[model samples]
Every structure is written in C-alpha cells, then in structure tokens.
Target: YRTAAASASLPTFLLVGPSGSGKTAFATLTERTSIAQTHTSTQPLTIEALLPSPHVPASSHYRSPGDPAYERSRRFLLLDTPGHGKLRHYATASLSDPKSIRGIIFVVDAAALAEEPGLNEAASYLHDVLLSLQKRYTSATSSKGPTGIPVLVAANKMDLFTALPANLVKHQLEKAITEVRTSRAKALRDAGAALSGGEDEVDEEREWLGEGGEGHFEFSQMQEIGTSVSVVGANVLGGKETGSVDGWWEWIGENL
Candidate 1:
C-alpha cells in the first residue's frame, strides 16, 4: 500500500474486471454517487472511454455512470474494461504500458457463481482476470515505485448466490496469485542485478528466475469493498473483514 503524501496529488485508480462483475457498479460506489448527490438516478451516465493509446481522440467511449461524488474528483478515472476470457487478453498489455493505469481494482462477482450461463462464467473469467492483473502489476513494478501502485481485489455483488463458501473461491485463486507474485519478485531481483555498475547485461544471467521467475503471488487476500453488498458480502465484509465498512476510506487513504 502506498499513500500520496500531503503535497502529492490524489492517486488515480483504474477499475478493471469481467463483464457483469459489477466493475461499473463498484466504481459508482467508490464515486459515492448517491450520498454525494441529492438523489440516485437509475439512468446510466457516460463515464468516458479510453483509447488503446494515450494520445488522440478516443475512437470509442465505453459507457459508465457518474453522479456528484465521481464528478467531484478529477483524479479517479475508472476504465470500464470489456468482460473476461477475451478482455483479459488485453490486460497484460494495458497494465504493462503503465501510462494508462495507476491502481487496479479487480472485481469478482460472488453472486454470479451459481448461475448457469452468464454469471458463473463471468465470475470465473473475472477471477482469472484478477490472477492475470495481479501477476502483471507485480511483474511490472517489482516493488520499485516511489509508492507502489496498489491493487484491490474486490468481490462484488455478494447480494446474490450466497451459498458458495469464501474458502472455495480463495482456494481456486491461490495458485494464480502465487504465480504472479513469484513473477514479480523475480523481476525485481533481475532489475536489481541489472543495475550493478559496470556490468554488461548478460543473456543467461537475466534468465535466473526461469521463464516466469520465482516467489509467490499474493495480496491482502480478496476483500469485499464495493458499496452494494449481498447477504453473503455483508456477512463476510461487515462481519469478518477488517476493512469492509470503511474499506474504501482506509484503502484510498493508504493508496492515495
């Protein structure tokens, strides 16, 4: 976790997750549209689109909503990325670029797991996206930034499909998270070695970590941090999780 010093600008966070995983909803919650505004509108608002590249006009705009809270800040730019399976394809590149993202919020839909078609599949894809993003962020940084870019694993929409155990989901995700962390730790080690003075970058020596590298992929395990909550989510976050109630405030403050 990295905090923006008092003099520094507020940290900008980018939201990414599978379709129907409520990435947009989580953004709405973070933006705090309802409380920030006199009332909440059902209408969908345009959240703005990001081009594949930073320069020039956006060829397209992905739609997301905004109310008083989100509009209040110029810093938070949540990318409504396309859903998983296919969308996950672009994530590695986007994250590697660094120019487009500051922090990543990987949303997984807990309620969707039981559903037959969309929800379950979406949930699974979202989970994979989290794994990939977690790996990429760790790999790119290797803990080198002045303030490390934070990644929040958001379990969204716990209001539905309350049956599945948290342990189960965490089990499936563990391997992926470990791999990413391992890759990143290896990257950092290589970067450190490369910085040694008066040494030519060696081909074989750079391969020290093997293809992906070594170590473990980990985060303060996934947290239920979105505004809209499920019975399952409420039970998990409100009841057990340390940061559920004030999760956003604490996380934002820490990562800002």
Candidate 2:
C-alpha cells in the first residue's frame, strides 16, 4: 500500500482535446513507444510512462543516468481524459481535485481544425480549460500564489496534406476563442439581467478572458494568470514516415 501510494503521487499531465484528435494514439505511443490502433475512449485512463532517451527532465538535468534521482525524475503519470463533450466530467474532477498535476496537453487534429465546427469545438474546450486554470490561480489563498500550470496545445495530424501549419493552428484557435469569449460574456450579461431585472451590473471582468478591451485574444494573456500556453506541431501516426512527437515529449519533460 505504501508503494502504491508513492507511485500514485508522481507528477501528472492531463491529456485532453476533442475526439478523434489522436489523444489516445499519443498516450499509447508514449507508454509503449509504438503506435497502436485505438477506438474512441469512453472513460479516463491513467498510465505510467518515463521520459525517453536524449531528452532530459528539467529536474534531472545535472543528474546522470543510473542515478536514483535521475531515474525517479523520469517517472511520471499521463492522465488521458475522454474528449467527448458529454463525458468531460472526468476532466473536470481532475482539474478541481488537488493532485500532483504538472501540466495539460491539449491534442487537436490539424486537418480537422480547418473546418468551422472543429475550430469552434476546440476553441470552446480550450477556453474552459484555460479559465479553470485562471480561476484556480486567482482563488488561491497563498501570499506567494499557487504554482502556475502550463498548457501545451499539441497540433497533431501533420502528416495529412490538408492539415494547417502550426502557426495557422495557433492563429485560428486564438481568433475563434476571441469570438467564444465575446459571446459567452454576452450570454452571462443576459442571464444576469434576467435574474436581477437589470438592477444589478454583471461582473464582466470576472467572466471575461484575457485582458480587457476590444483587442484580440492571445495565449500570452494567459501568462498574467499563471499559465503559459504553447502550440507545438507533431504527428503520432504518420504513414510511410515515422511520426514525430519529440517536441511534445520535450515540453512534458520541461514541465515535469
């Protein structure tokens, strides 16, 4: 029981995104070092994985291989949450629970992101995730503030010819999230007015995402809220060529 408890306390990276976005594929690959066929996940899955070679965990940079500290530093947990809209309570629980969460990896299909529905879906989910982190940061009671959580937007499916480049993926998501933020604020105002008969003003600042003003929303705004968002492109199951996901692993290592 003591051994199990110690293992369960390892730093965890939450894997979340829209369905069919390669979240399972990436998770499976990270655990087995090989891609495997996957079906749409219906529940959250947690797996223990180690940092592969040539890449070093930030905490183990000075420690050489074979050292106990270096080996322990490579050990961490990857929590894969179902991306389906109706089943996101699992992710919500993880986010709300006080655990050893280190970072979040949001996987998205680059090819699908080209369409309106896909972009909107990804943007909405991402907005909520970032807002949760923001709320957590602001609600902390510590004088020094809580440890900030970083986010990695893994733009997957680059092997497909229709996929958007990494830069466009970042831009498109930012633009779509701006629209989502505006619409959400409007809805909140309407609901608040209905409840108070327009006698009370809504707290737009609390509901608003990023900085105030008509300016576009950028990931950099998250920096002020104790979260750093990074968009990195990689494919987990490339045909004819080996898939590349080293960048994501490096990001995970840095956070771990």
Candidate 3:
C-alpha cells in the first residue's frame, strides 16, 4: 500500500484536446519513444513516463544526472483523457480534482485549427477548460489561494504544409475563445430571460472567463487567475523518422 501511494503521488500532467488532435500520438511517443498507429481513444489512459535525457527537470536542474534525487525528479504520470465530446467527463473530473496535476497539455492539430469547424471545436473545449481553472482560482478560500496550474497549448502536426504557425495558432484561438465567451454569456442571459422570476438569478460573474470586460480574451488574461498559457509548435510524425517534439519536451521539462 505504501508503494502504491508513493507512485500515485507522482506529479501528473493532463493530456486533453479535440479528437484526432494527436493527444494519443503524443502519449504513445512519450511512453514508447516512437509513434504508433493510434486510433481514437474512448477511455482515459494513465502511464508512468520519465522525462527524456538531456532535458533535466526544472526542480533538479542543479543536480548531476547520476544523482538519485535528479533521477527521481524525472518521474511523473501522464494522464491522457479521451478527446471525444461524450468522453470528456474524464478530463473534467481530473480538472475538478487536480490534487496531483502539475500542468495541462492541450494538443491541437495546427492544420485543423486553420479551418472554421475544427477551430470552433478546439476553442470551445479550451474555453471550458480555462473557465474551470478560473473558477478553481476564484473559489479558493485560503489567503494564499490554490496552486496555479499552467497550460501548454501543444500545436501538433506542424510538419503539415497547411499547418498554422505557432503564433497564428495562439492568435486564432484567442479570437475564437473571445467569440465563444460572448455567445456563452448571451446564452445564459437568454435562458434567464425566458424564466419568469429572478429567484434563481444566474451567476454570470462566476461563468465569465477572464476579466469582465468588452475586450478580447487573450491567454495573458489567465495570468490574473494564476494560470499561464503557452503555445508551442511540434510534429508527432512527418518530419524525421521520429518527428520533432523537442520543443514540447523542453516545455515539459521547464514545467516539471
């Protein structure tokens, strides 16, 4: 039991995104050192993985590679949740109960994000994820507040010719999330208006993401709530034999 508890307490990173956005591919590559032919996952998968060589964990950067503490710091759990719409409760549950969660990796198909439908789907899911984080921060009762959970927007499939660059991915997502925020607030108001009484007034403030203003929603806005967002471009396949996820791994090392 003690052994199991120790392993369970390892820092965990949540992997979430829209379907076919390469969440499973990234997980498989990280676990096996090679990408496999992955199908759409319907269930959440948890795997123990080590941070690869040459990239030291931020927590133990000063220690030499052979040190036991340095090696132990590289240990962590990768929790890959299903990206399918109906299967997202696993991700939501993890967010709500993020005891061991160190960070969130939201993978996106850079090329798909260039189109309207794909962009909207990714943006909508991302909006909800960030909103949950915002709510978690605002609802904390302690003076120091809860520990911040940073986010990494992994822009996958960068090898694709049509893939949007990392900067454009960041810009477009912010724009789409702004629209999603507006429509969601409008929806809440419409629903409340349809009701006769104000007995159950909707808490729009709680539902609103970022500062309550008419301005656009940027990832920077999350800073006020203690969550930092970053977008890094990478390819899980198509570049070289193994593809380039060095940037993603580096980001993970930094956060680790």
What are the C-alpha RMSDs, in order, of all predicted structures?
A: 13.7, 1.7, 2.0
* lDDT (C-alpha) at residue 20 in model 2: 91
Candidate 1 has a TM-score of: 0.45
Writing each residue's lDDT as its tens digit, candidate 3 over 1-256 gives 3387777988999999999999988888877855589999999998888899888899998899889899889988889999999999999999998868999999999999999899999999999999999999999999999999999999999888899999999999999999999999988887887784554367899999999888899999999998999999999988665358888888889989
Better of 2 and 3 by lDDT: 3
- Off-target runs (Cα >4 Å) in candidate 1 are 1-10, 29-75, 88-93, 113-147, 161-168, 175-246
Give model 2's TM-score versus the native structure. Answer: 0.95
Looking at candidate 3, the ten consecutive residues that score lowest on lDDT are 193-202
lDDT of each: 0.42, 0.89, 0.91
When sorted by lDDT, best at the front, the candidate numbers are 3, 2, 1
| Stretches of model 3 off by over 4 angstroms after superposition | 197-200, 241-243
TM-score of 3: 0.95
1-256: candidate 1 lDDT, tens digit per residue: 3253521333345556556566555455544535232122222232432212122121112322254333233233455455545555455555555454556666556555444553445434434444444444344544452233456555554444462344444443444445444554556567757787433344432222223334542334323111111111221222233224244333433343
lDDT-best of 1 and 3: 3
Report the C-alpha displacement of residue 83, candidate 2, in angstroms.
0.5
